[model samples]
Target: MNITWNKRQLELRERFREVATDLVAVGSDARDRDASFDRELWKELAAADFWRLQVPTGAGGLGKDGWDWLAAMEGLSLGARDLGFLMSVASHSGLIRLLLTAGTPEQQHRWLPGLTSGEVAATGSTEESGGSDIRGLSTRAVPTADGGFVLNGAKAHITNAPVADVVMLAARTDTEPGAFELSLFVTRTDVDGVGSGPGEDLLGLRTSPTGPIAFRDVRVDADAVIGGVGEGLTRLYNTLAYDRILFGIIVGSSLEAQLEPLVRQLETRHAFGAPLSAQQYMQEKVVSLTMAVEGSRALAYRSFGQLEDQHDGYSLSASVTKLFASTGLVGSGLDLVQAFGHSGYESGSAVERNLRDSVAFKIAAGTDEMQKKNIFNHVRRAYRSGELAPGSRGSGT
Candidate 1:
């Protein structure tokens, strides 16, 4: 928990914290009331190189190891109340990785600079009605007479739909199941037939600009296909592997951030003729929840290390981290709400916001159930393959 950062990372993390706190002060109320999108804050991040923190060095980015970047990101996420902003930044970070991983040199040179400079917004598209299930996305691309292609189908839950200029999108390029069947295409958001719906009325992260859009026969040149046709899944999967681990940091640290302030309140305020902290039962409850926070922090940091090491086992590591962190969040959140009695349960308090937001953590990036399922699948692939044991389910552990 006392891990020291090098001078460069320390400076970067402190700057992010200062700026993020300022942004929260300016944007939190507006976001809570109207689900406002912080265009100005996004511009500041771009100027500060926050968007390019994970980009390759050649792409004009800081290019820290993925884990180091997560550490920096968690520092910003700690005590952060702007749900929409955290989700937005995290989503864009994933898209940046997708571009850096799959873009050709020429393509990288042409687009990455703009991304790093904040001249454009970036996003990825792959979700369908079934929640971005790899095989369930039905977006399609047809060859054009001029060596380009026509894209059709809509993407729901597309993040940053309102402002993104470059999108890493996926679609069916052929009927086969080959790696080439599903290709990744980069499209200009300003292209013809590109339009977006309003953000949703969500229980949390409402400030995020989530929406749906139809391709409606959109056009793209031949050079837009990243890593060629049918390599979309590979590219997307690689980006999300890094993305999911960061998700644990964002979710875990934010919960910790929210709970810490409330704990101080409990320490100062009396509930039954004595300060909540003085009551044995309340002390026990707060310590118990603090233990959950410490565990979440440990797992989050551990997973980030695995990611930076380029561990082949990061997928499983991420799943375990997320599973532990999120389950702890649910428990810790309940403890937080119950501790304040009706005061915490009412609207307007930070605890209420954290409570709503924590519920959403059970589902974002990857759900608790999804993490367990992926862990089980990882076990099967890594251990149970070719084993002939009867009814033996391999443990992902």
Candidate 2:
């Protein structure tokens, strides 16, 4: 697959880079230190149409598809240099992806405009008890005689929860013993019986607000159902697969942006009366980082291609990409910190922040263990059906 961007894509990326540097990067360090979320900066991004990059023209969005959106996000990652902020963006994009793929026309009309105009959105799937285990989720939405549902449960560790205007959430709609029956719903946070807690102080990605959302007899109209009732699992997983693809894209592009600075540091920093660049060990670090960047981008692009085509293997490809990209990012982040020595280790330094932020990639979207399980399950099914050859799953098609 040719990974080179066309001229327009390149230009879009550059434009977003400028936007990130000017609007998003400013006060990023302070925000990280204080664990703050800047609403104004979010609005700045909206004013620049950053959220519309991937929206379809028919949906009253900018007329670009997934490829163009990926290019714009690549630029944002390069220029922002703030992973916490990017994490927030990724979380918001998850909701957008769900709407674009599965939303009704009325849903899109009501939410898309606000979403593109800086009204914060969040996806509530991971519960305190369930994490990424959908079968374990307990939030319930019981149907009322009027055809509406009364939602009663809470979502924990949700991004943007503390300030979201709306949430796209999954809740149990059936309770047949030992069965998993869920439905997706969209609701305004300002409505009665909905509440959000204070943001949690985390080890990393502190700049992005992460918190809990609660629903106590929250009434939602029948129109709030997304995809359909009793049909949420498929749509949920599809959204998740898309999210994993995004993780690969974000990690790959962010690492590429760090490459030049790493090169400069190695060439200029002397140790043992010679430049660090002269040391084979140091050179190996650069080589590892370069490989990670390339590997991630290749898999990301391939999986995204499969997703756009609605290929049956998209889920498997997406899982592999997330597993590989997250591992590579955390490992390479440490390599960068080690390369810079004390300066890199200094608190509030860019490299140190990067190292901290990179840790979340392993745990968010889906954990590495979860990805492995998904990969195994998908490959086993294919192998059993005689659809895949012995070694072809790992062939990276």
Candidate 3:
């Protein structure tokens, strides 16, 4: 795939880089230590129109494509150096896309402005019982006499829950146990019976506040349903298709950022009267990391192309991209720590923070094991259906 950025896209990416460097760099250590989200930085992002890049022009957004959005995200990740803040932005972007894709006209009209203008949003799909398993969700949404629904359940580890203005809540609306029985609702967080749990102090991404959200008989009219009743799974999977690709970019870019500074340090720092970069072992490690970053970029952009083209294998491609990129990121982070040695391990060091942050990529979109399982299932199904050549099953796709 030819992944070329035009003049306009390049310009936008540079602009994002500058803004992120200026706004997100300050007090990063303090914010991470305090486990606080930077509301002021968020305002700066809003003023720069970072939040509306993916929203369509008709809905008062910038009408940029997926590639442009990914580029901007990469720029921000490169400059920000704060994984928590990037997580918040990525979550907000995902919710905006979901709204644009499935929200009714009135629903979009009501929420798109605020959402695109930097008002935070959260997704409440994972319950305490199940992390990413939609089948294990127990949240219930029973229809009321007034044609609305009364939602009752809890969502755990919800990003931006404490400050979100709106939440995309998924709950079981039917008795039968299956993916299709679920429905997606745009629930206002301020409504009665909706409560947020205390913020969690996480190992990484500490600047992004995450907590549980409770829904005790939360009521919403039928108009709150996104897409349609029993279509939550479909909409969710659709959103994941894009989200996984963006995540690949996020991890890849962050790794690239970490790799660059380490490389510079290795080139300048001397050990045994020789630059660290002159060491054969260190050179090999840096070369491997550089290759990984490039490979991840290729996979991410290729997956983006597949999605844009609506390829039959886009889902499989996206999963592979996420798997490859996230694993590469974690590996590269380890390489950075090794290259920097004791200095890298020091408290408040960028390399140390990156090592802590890179780990979350493996668990965020889906775990490494989960991605492998998805790849295996998809390939197995294809092979059984005679899609694979006689001896091509073990060969790389």
Candidate 4:
């Protein structure tokens, strides 16, 4: 199931593995204890340039090629038991990427270096009560006579809200409800009247900060508008393909990391005078796990390649890839729990962490149902256009 890594990718994986081992040791504690993100790991990863792995050299990152960056992230995610760490790093990239794509030169110069250096953390606010309905957002930023703007609204389920150095918030700037009037604003979290509090107590990824941020007459200069008004939704949705691709990569990586270790345990341990691996029942279970992991990796890698080639069909593939990776991987996780029995259920075991973390992936990039529904809608329209191809119809047909 493993893809061939180039020399450079191999080198990068080795480097990240060192950090991954350290993270695995403490990630479970942080997740289960409902602790805030671990500052120590954040500092070490930032110092190691791990935080800036994918950022452009123009912006002070390692400038790792697209494949290398995706590969390294998948590898690290497999071993990183800390969902919070993964979420924090991802939120950081989301903010940086949007700014780099949409920010003015002055804005990039002013903020990119700090983000790459980890001098400050970043987060995004796009999803809301309407469920990613950017056009329907209740949040607004209005013109002020002083030439600045007054912002008023709130964002829910924001990752890194408690410690974000900067946040890219999307707001409507015109009367059009469905067109792209949304503007992306890069605001300092400490702006007067801008505050996040009352963190939500969650069932999983509890280690990551998830809270509501309220903006009350928050003031900002014209410079606060990223890429200016009228371009926010464009950049925000543009980033989704890459983000969803990585989300798929991580799902494959995490489940495989947990499953293989348990397979070995079953291979050697005797059960009723025979190794569990020797029993037809256990053998069947192992085969199922193998298929799940391999299936996820195959779908993810294909999607990654499409992304690398800038293929036109990638957006649709990304939906399918993300949907399968998020859901199929969990079916494989059953092996870890069943093969190891009660030991797999222990809070200290990697299997336990995998079980807890797997549930969140569907919700992370997008829900499993959402992915299917979005792709189904695309397919439905494609069918009507006679572009879905002969026999290319989806099962919902």
Q: Give the alpha carbon lDDT tens digit for every residue of 210-259 in model 3.
A: 99999998889989888898898877776676777877777766677767
**Cα lDDT of model 2 by residue, 180-237, tens digit:** 8889999999999999998999988989999999999999999999999998988888
Q: Name the lDDT value of residue 39 in candidate 3.
A: 73
Candidate 4, number of clashes: 0
Number of the top lDDT candidate: 2
lDDT by residue (tens digit), candidate 4, 1-397: 2467888887777677666767644555745575666666666777777757766777677777666876677667766766666766777777776665567777877787777665545455544575444556778888788877788898878777876777778776776555547777878887798888776777667677777778888998888888767777666655666667767666666666666676788888897898888888888877776666676667767766765566656777778877877766666666677788988888757667667666777776567777887788877888898876878654321
Taken over the whole model, the C-alpha lDDT of each candidate is 0.71, 0.90, 0.81, 0.71
- C-alpha positional error of residue 342 in candidate 2 after TM-score superposition, expressed in Å: 2.0
Estimate the lDDT of model 4.
0.71
TM-scores for all candidates: the values are 0.87, 0.96, 0.94, 0.87
Question: Which residue runs of candidate 4 sit more than 4 Å off their true CA positions?
Answer: 1-4, 23-27, 119-122, 126-128, 132-135, 145-148, 176-180, 305-310, 346-348, 391-397
On TM-score, the leading prediction is 2
Against the true structure, candidate 3 reaches a TM-score of 0.94
* RMSD of candidate 1 to true structure, Å: 3.7
> Residue by residue across 64-148, what tens digits does model 1's lDDT show?
7654566568767763577567877777777666666667878887777877676545454546566636677788899998999
Q: What's the lDDT for candidate 3? A: 0.81
